[model samples]
Target chain A: MLGYIDKIREIGERLFTDGKVDVVIGFAKGSMPMMNEPMMARSSGDLQKMVWDGNCGINLANYLTNRKEKIGIVAKGCDSRNIVTHIIENKIKRDQLYIIGVPCKGMIDRRAISKAVPGEVTEVIETRDSIRVKGRDFDETFDRGDVLQKNCAVCLHRNPVIYDELVADPVVEQTGIDRYEDVRKIDSLSTEEKWRFFDDLLSPCVRCYACRNACPLCYCPTCFVDESKPQWVGKGIDDIDIKTFHFLRAYHCAGRCTDCGSCERSCPVGINMRVLTKKLEMDCKDLFDWEAGLTLDKRPPLDTYRPDDPNNFIK
Target chain B: MDFMGIERDRLHLSWISSAEATKFIDVVGEVTAAIKALGPNTNFVKNKAKAA
Candidate 1:
């Protein structure tokens, strides 16, 4: 994974020197371990700050919304999909983007490592298949597959769906993976059990909108949670209000969500909000035979109406 | 809604013309029965005491 940084810098340099793009967006090593932050390199000198690794989990496409400048962005499989989503939604023009695609090999779940280790992790070293974590009092090695973020573990699209430049050859996409196993487990639960499941799942949320802010698709100027005209939801952290916020947010992304796992990653409380979105994603695939952001041409199922559209929900 | 444990019958959507009063009445009856069978919606209802 570390080897990709040199190639990323090489591409950023060419894009800057050739005057093809005004800025190159990529990741830089964060102050702490497992916290790579997005960095926008404006010149060849700035390219040295760019880095890539399993820690580059935050979706870079969130920064691309409504931008007017010609941008050269580093995109993983999910980020590239979101770029396609942005173009389809007219958030940014396709011609203005110089996509630098990176074949992803899943991002590390820092929380899992934190749980496994005895102390705060100060450094994380990644090789092809092993992760070495070092902390104040202890050091440990873990297989990469065991600590991958849940979405990446079952990700079927490791190769970017669209790109102008490839950092390396596309990695083999995972096949025969049951992406919706957890969703199916929840689906089989009784009504009361399901209600309690989400209640417990979301009880820790402090109404911090990190999940909403991290999602590339949630580009609304005034999110429903903040609107006070009719006061759709209460300001306090009431149970119903929290449920309303999550439920409506999931509904909004029914067909548009790409299962990027940004929401889950950004949540301070570590709530797996992906369960709600993944349920909707499963429904979209089962009913409409559609996946989000695979192509630039086709409109999302929710965006267009057809005579054969499924109305099974209607009484 | 059903996935989140809201009873599937709690919300109903249908198309009926203004002229079709009979169809409207039938749909309303169905909706009423569905909700009545599920009892009061205790899961999502805001707790008045907590809010106050």
Candidate 2:
């Protein structure tokens, strides 16, 4: 992890000193444990402050939308995928930025570790295989893979699909994993059970919209939630209102979401929102044989339909 | 979804997992009747008509 941090700073310095990019987007040491903040660097002086580790979970590609400056941004597999989606969507021209790709090892789930700790987790130490968590009176160790974010555990792309340079040798992507096993479990449920399952899942939502704001795909000028003339979803905290908001939020991201886990990471209450997106991703893959952000030339599943599209679901 | 504009009843593609096979048939029967009661799709068209 430390070696990667040095490599990232070295690349950031070169990009800044050579005047190849006006701003560099990456991570900096956070003020608290299991946290790293997205940072923007303009000079080698600012580049010196960059850091990288499992805590660099926030996707930096979320900052690329509508920016005109030449950007040198660090991207993990998911971030790079989001970047591909962005270029395809015309949010940022491909030639306008340099991607510093990081071959990712799955990011650790901070909430999982925090929940496991007996006391406040004040310090987190990471090695290649294990994480040693420490606080005032307790110290515990966990296998790195066991504590990975659910999305990372099932991630198909660990290496950036596109990049100008890589900070390290590409990590092997996961294979033979049933990424939709949970979705299948839910799909096996009756309609009423399925509705109850989601209702229970989303009941704890506080309507913070943190998940919406954290998503790279949600760049709508006036998000449906904010529309006044015919407000698509109400502002109150009613149960159906929350469900409607979440339903549309996931629907809007039908074919474009990269399974980046940023939406779930940003939720204040840890809603496990990936269930909704994963269901759509499964549908896209099974019904259309499509994966988002894998290629620039191909259109997303929902963007185009074939005459032979499956019609088995209709009665 | 574009087919909804012409005839909303044109598509209903569902694959029942073997585990849900026994129950999904009943659900499909209910869904078919619900679609019949809903009538033709005019959601976006009505909005455009109102604007015109």
Candidate 3:
């Protein structure tokens, strides 16, 4: 990943030197194995610590959503989509941000790594090519593509859809992998079965709000659940409260979610939160035939209506 | 007026995909035409006195 490091250093130096940005938010080598830590560099000296490689999987856009300061960011395909959504929703100003777009084949999942090689993974060594995990007795070498996230298997874009700088040559093969099949299968289930699935899925949520906090699209001045007056959802995980949380989150994200998949990745309990957004994505497609974050000029689907839209709600 | 009870000049219909770039333009054209035909959806009510 020397190319990645080189690009980060070059961009960081240029941004700091040119007074283009006050902060550069990128990934630094994490102290823990198989983890990439988010770093905010204020000066060229701190740019030395910035690195990028196969394991820089965590979506960094989640951290940059609300900051008003001038900033630069390292965006993968998914992260770029999140940036587009934020700009469209008027949550962040595009002119204040400089994006260094990097092509990605998808970063490796740390949990998947632990599963593939049981026992203590002392360190992870990743290069511009492959990853080798050092552990008890077995130092397994793996191609970077072999252990990508499930969501990345059918990535729609390898290059950033929007960027000011390109770190590497784009890998442009638009794989037509439909993401709605899982949502469709779940949709076909009986109402009872659906209830059972949600019951199982949300039971583990400790109301930590990590998923909500980590989402870039969830930038609201005041979240409804946090409101004390007529408190929407109580501070516990009952069936009703958990169901309300997911429903409200899904409703709030209607026509606004870009399918960045950070909410799913941030969940410590491993709830398949992508299922919620995937279903919302399907609804937006089927009803309004609109996808979020592609453009800033158009209004969101739920915020507007046509005279001849489906009239199923009429009495 | 058409057989489906919609006036040809008054009605607009479109089929679109999620990724289509030009569909928004099509929808906006149709909606603006429709809105011009029928007045705005809401009117300004400065107060209850204005409503009365």
- State the weakest 10-residue window (summed lDDT) of model 1 chain A: A306-315
TM-score of chain B of each: 0.85, 0.43, 0.41
The lDDT of model 2 is 0.85
Ranking by TM-score: 1, 2, 3
lDDT of the structure predicted as candidate 3: 0.75
Per residue, candidate 3 scores C-alpha lDDT tens digits across A36-123 of 7889999999999888877676677777766899999999888887788778666679998899999887777667777888688997
Q: In model 2, how large is the Cα lDDT of residue A184?
A: 82
**Tens digits of per-residue lDDT for model 2 on B1-52?**
2211123343456656789976698877876776787665433221222232
Model 1 Cα lDDT, one tens digit per residue, A286-313: 9999899899989999879999998977
- In model 3 chain A, which range of ten residues has the least summed lDDT? A306-315
TM-score for all predictions? 0.98, 0.86, 0.80
RMSD of each: 1.1, 8.4, 12.3
A best-first ranking of the candidates according to their lDDT comes to 1, 2, 3
DockQ of 1: 0.81
